[model samples]
Target: MFIDVLKNIVITIVTVLIFISAVEIMVPSNKMKKYVNFVLGLILISVILSPIVKFLSNGDKEIVNSIKSYEEIFTDNQNKFKSDNVSTLKNNGKEDTKKELFIRNFNKNCEDLLKNKFKEMTFKSELECDVDFNNITFNIKKLRIGIADSKVNKIKKVRINKEKTDNKEENEEYSEVVNYISNQLDIPKEKIEIYKLEE
Candidate 1:
């Protein structure tokens, strides 16, 4: 009980400091250094308390475990992002055109993969795919679609969408989506496969 009170007190103090910093920045003060100090102080307080905030917010052990599982999904998705097929596809100057083609092709492949290739998908309640869109060499960044919410359906399903960029981050957002689904649904990482468009 004491620990909780202390944490709340610290959080409240940090929140007040942020508000004060914003107010200080808006005020017509000749002391620019003081304003900067206030802003920096606010940032420092937030940096220190962010983890605490997350801990406080995730009061449930199950939720926290689910988040860990979600992280694993993200890790696996990243491994798939680095696959040869993904690397082979490049996004050049004509990104938009390639994106359209990739999406069309990806959707077709997903339908086929679910129906003919990986029949297990239709049996599951979730489907997701991620695409990278800004690969200037192939003109693709990332694309992803997935079932974001499923607590009501009593079914766990995800549809991932992503766009790959020229930078390594192109596939990162897609990984985030997968991680999010895994975390939200409390699904184990082993149960989810990184959905990719076959080259």
Candidate 2:
């Protein structure tokens, strides 16, 4: 490679010198000849140093090319990261929708089951649950049941100053319902709450 470069430099110098000599011979006046010779001398010097200058500047070209390549790679990685984030967001939205659907279905099924067992009572249920997406497991946290007896049309009003009293019959009925729910759903009674609904 070094030999080839040297050969090309020598050939360029010789060609430039020959062209300068031809221009010098064609000069019309002695004063113009002096100016032309000075210009030709500068051209000759440039022709001789061009190979060395090009060799030094070659590294700069390589650096520019390398920087451009790195920039392209960085842009590609950035675009990929953005796309991955967008896809992850979409997946999260889908999971949220699925979780909501599961909760709604679970609440409806529980209400239907309770309604079937207690025909004289209407049951409205609200439940809180924990779902593990990775493991695909569900844990019921709390279950709230609002019970309204179909036979009762009006709720009795109680004064705030009156002493609190427990109705044994109502307590026993609530306990039985709680026990039945615990046994059927495999849920602890402590997590279940039964409330009387006012009409």
Off by over 4 Å in 1: 1-95, 120-199
With a 3 Å backbone cut-off (N, CA, C), the pairs that clash in candidate 2 are none
User: What does candidate 1's lDDT look like per residue over 1-199, in tens digits?
Assistant: 3365468868877787787668666767677768677776777778667657865786566466767878899999888878745555543435556655766775565444434533333312223334465443332223233222212334324335423332233234345544654565454444444433322
Displacement of residue 98 (Cα, Å) in model 2 is: 2.0
Q: Give the top-scoring candidate (TM-score).
A: 2
**Lowest-scoring 10 consecutive residues by lDDT in candidate 1?**
142-151
Model 1 vs. true fold: TM: 0.19
Deviation in Å, model 1, residue 148 alpha carbon: 13
How accurate locally is residue 104 in candidate 1, as Cα lDDT from 0 to 100? 73
Q: What does candidate 2's lDDT look like per residue over 1-199, in tens digits? A: 4466578888999999899989987888878788888999999999888777886879577657777878999999999999999999999998888888888888898889888998998888888998778899999998887788878455556656433333333435588778888898898987887777777
